[model samples]
Target: MPHQPIPPPHRTYARAMRAEATKPENLLWQALRNRQLEGFKFKRQVPLDGYILDFVCFEARLIVEVDGGQHSGAIGDAVRDRHFEAQGFRTLRFWNDEVEKELDAVCRAILHEAEGRIG
Candidate 1:
C-alpha cells in the first residue's frame, strides 16, 4: 500500500470552509461558479500563501471576499490585502449585507475587476 500524505492544515481548513460556506458566500458562488461570470473561472475556499481566500480567479489574479460585520475596519484584512497585492493579486471585499442586498452590483464589480485584470 502506498502512503498518502496528509493535506496541509490550511488546505484542510479551506475544504472545511467550502463545505460550511455562509449564505452570502453561497449566493456569490452561484453567480461565479462554472465560468458563469464572463467565462472566467472562480474557485471558492482556496488556500494560498498561508491564507484561505473566499474566492479566487487565478487567471485574473483577483480575489473576492464576502465578509460579515466582524470584518469591518479590520486591520488584519488590510494586512492580508497588502500581502496579496505584493504577490500581484488584487483583493475585493463585500459586506454580508451588501452581498445579500446587492448581488447584481457585486457581480458587476467582480466582472469589471476580472476584465481589467485579464486585460
Candidate 2:
C-alpha cells in the first residue's frame, strides 16, 4: 500500500478561498479564467512561497492581489512583494472597490502587465 502525502496548509487554505471567493475576486476571476486575458493562463487562489496568492500567471510571472480596506498601507504587503519580486514575479494590487467599479480598467491593466512580462 502506498501512502499519500498530505497537502500543504497553504494549499488547503487556498482551495477554501477559491470556493468562497470574495465578490471582487470572483469578478476578476471571470476575466482571467480560460486564458481569456490575451491567451495568458491564470490560476486563482494559488499557494506559493508560504502565501496564498489571489491570482498568478506563471508564464508571465505575475501575481494579482485584490485587497480590501483592511489592506490599506499594509507593511506586510511590502515584505511579501519583495519576496515575490526576488522570485522574479511582479505583484499587482487593486482595491476591492476598484475591482468592482472599474473591472474593465483592471482587466486592461492586468493584460498589459501580463503582455509586458510575456513579451
Question: Per-residue error at 5 for model 1, in Å?
Answer: 13
C-alpha lDDT values of all predictions: 0.92, 0.91
Q: Over the stretch 86-115, how does candidate 2's per-residue lDDT look in tens digits?
A: 888999999999999999999999999988
Poorest lDDT segment (10 consecutive residues) of candidate 2: 1-10
**lDDT score, candidate 2, position 63:** 97
TM-score of each: 0.93, 0.92
Show pairs that collide, candidate 2.
Answer: none
Cα displacement (Å) at residue 50, model 1: 0.7
- Determine the backbone clash count of candidate 1: 0
Best candidate (score: lDDT) = 1
User: Model 1: runs farther than 4 Å from truth?
Assistant: 1-7
Report the Cα lDDT for residue 101, model 1: 99
Candidate 1: give the clashing pairs.
none
lDDT of prediction 2? 0.91
Each model's backbone clash number: 0, 0
